[model samples]
Target: DIKILQLSLRSADLCIESGTLDLSLKILERAAVRVERLEIFSGDDDVPIGRTLSAKYYMLRTLLAWHQTRPDLAEHMLCMIPEEAINNDLQLASELADLCYNVGQQAFSKGQFDLAAKWLEKAAKHNSRSLNAGDENSPNVKLRLIILHMTVRAYLEQNSGESRTKSLQTLEILISYYPNELAVLILWLEVMMKQGNPDHRIFYNRLETLVHVIELTDTNIKIILSYIQKLQEWSIEMCVRTLEQLLLRMPVLSDNEQWIDRLFVISIRLSTSSGVADSLSLLDAVATHLYDYLMKPLSQTTANASLIVRLGINP
Candidate 1:
């Protein structure tokens, strides 16, 4: 009940701040009833209410009473509550975490890393605990935890090398367990590249394994291909570098051409429909290299002109 009142107060505060006075008043009035129930339940005994209950009511009342005159006090009180208390109340925990996450992201965008770090960490932790409270082994829960850890690591990277290393290690372990996890793999590759470690060969080897898995499975090849294409679209440097290396190593021209054509088509569609052109030059470079190596000299011969034309390109 007390947790419900806390939620009501939070909503009321938001409504008031946004000038929805009617909604705010209704929520506040409902919260008042909950507060009265809390007081009655606690009774006139010398003993106090449970710590969690007290904290909930305190947070609700303090937030409800917030005004310009005592804004600092309210803020301080709000911050004083232990974040762990939120873990016991899942609904409130999720709401508060989301609010903090949004505020943190805005602060990050505004170049307030210190402030952003504090709020984002809180949000991540709350979400993590809420997820963990249920099934720790659930795929969705694990993914959320990975995201939270990643967010915290990003914030800590600016301040501590140890934190960054630890986060990277955690990601490495996760990828080892879930090799098909493309999102985690992408971030792991980025982190490895950023570290500038000569041991990056290991990550490349893992990537090769992933590609082989896609080839073997045939069932999700399209999905796996889409992931690779997204990675290429993410950056020109990555696209050029990865494709160049793949072309150097892979002897199967037909397979490589199929993959390249898919990525190129996707890029063109993105550019035409959304006006978001990225790494087109890189695509052109790879395509030019492939065409020059596979088609140009062949097209120079009269017998091969028909072959080149059959491949849907001008000879």
Candidate 2:
């Protein structure tokens, strides 16, 4: 039975590689029968043989079900496999991770956001469980990034709160690894804003790093606007200060008019709001800067200048 099982496994793999789904399913069906007759059950991570092999077997079965267009069956087959068995086998875990990630992304492309999120979460579990944190080289960082980003995107599409939580956790680890990466930094800020009442200081502190990011793309501008709105509610003074720092860091002569006016209006709201009665001068400083750069011809020369000015002027 073991000999035939090996032959079936090998033949099924070849069939899968050769695009012969029916043949692969037939081989896997035969293997499943022989394996079931042996009555092997999955066991603890340290335990080998029966249980571990069963997990691998089920994984193959799951793949066959997937190719057969039976996602329900594929999902069920995957659920039956003990996570430990896959986690202990790095190669198996990575393969499963890739498979699930691909399926999730495919689902996302089709606008099946909720299902995409579920599959990506499963992929994250498979990859994370196998990751040997103590070993400097265990988890492939690139794959980890892909999983985190896709999962975050899935949640964002659904407008679910999990995007903020999952991405925040992943961002902490990812940021130190890719601090200078513009897209990741922007994402981190957006997630920071989405979080429910995270310490106001978190956004303020993030600005210390992110404000210097040169490109003021529309997405980044949206995140900045969100951050400013939150800061107004939390501390108008901090909002003004952050805006000032951002302007200083911005490339000279930006021309993004929309945001320049938006920022000026936010500053105006802050100044008029009751909390900053004694600090109207702070608002004045912000207003003056906006008028000098955003409304003037000098600021409209480049996208950078336009963007910088756009945030300064009010409608």
Winner by TM-score: 2
Error of 2 at 229 (Å): 4.7
- Each candidate structure's TM-score, on Cα atoms with residue i matched to residue i, is 0.48, 0.62
Error of 2 at 149 (Å): 3.7
lDDT of 2 by residue, 167-266 (tens): 5666676676667566666677677666667678766777656777646677666667676777666877788778766664443535555555566555
| lDDT digits (tens) for residues 250-287 of candidate 1 | 33424444444444444333333433344444445554
Superposed Cα deviation of residue 73, candidate 2 (Å): 1.0
**What TM value does model 2 have?**
0.62
- Clash counts for all predictions: 0, 19
Q: Which regions of candidate 2 fall more than 4 Å away from where they truly are?
A: 1-11, 17-19, 33-53, 82-84, 135-139, 155-199, 212-226, 251-315
Candidate 2: worst-modelled 10 consecutive residues by lDDT: 297-306
